[model samples]
Target: MTDIETRIEQIAQVIGQFDDAQVPRNIRTSSKEAVEQWLLNKNKEMDLRLGMTASIMDEIFNDSNLPIHFGPMCLQVQTVLETLLNEVRGS
Candidate 1:
């Protein structure tokens, strides 16, 4: 299995590809606005999924008394995503 850092960065890089590739080509200018709105909504949904995942991880951490290092590794993935979302929203 890949280590946490490598796997997270690999996922992030794939998401970057999706950001560029997910949209339909030959969209009308008026419809392009709608597509952009859909992308933003999808991004928000991704954020929510990440939040829920982290919450579940937090529950496990609390119940098991896992290493402090372990909690941050998972949380750091979410933090990286939050930064990406902020940048997408800002743009």
Candidate 2:
């Protein structure tokens, strides 16, 4: 797969880890939607998908009920998405 597609799959895997029952239901549900609805939506442009995913990750990072540990994970995912976005835009 291409670099962009590989990064997306990695992001999806990281999000999948948060799907555990340990996390709040809302966070889990939102993460799932971010992956399934936005990240994996081939109809949308890659840049658009990355932007939307980053937005969702930002929301998750700010969630009151989010575990402290998840904050860094969210940031990492957002950073990767942003980097990919920059590359996509610069090309």
The model with the greatest lDDT is: 2
The number of clashing residue pairs in each candidate reads 0, 0
Worst 10 residues of 1 by lDDT: 22-31
lDDT of 1: 0.40
- State the lDDT of candidate 1 residue by residue for 1-91, as single tens digits: 4343344345344333322232223212212332244322345464454344334434433534344444454355446645654554565
Q: Per-residue lDDT for 3-59 in model 2, tens only?
A: 889888998999888898778999999999999999989999989898998999999
Model 1 bad stretches (over 4 Å): 1-44, 57-64
Model 2 residue 13 CA deviation (Å) reads: 0.5
Clashing pairs in 2: none
Error of 2 at 34 (Å): 0.5
Candidate 2 has a TM-score of 0.95
Per-residue lDDT, model 2, residue 32, is 95
TM-score of candidate 1 relative to the true fold: 0.34
Please list the C-alpha lDDT of all candidates, in the order they appear.
Answer: 0.40, 0.91
Poorest 10 consecutive residues of model 2 by lDDT?
14-23
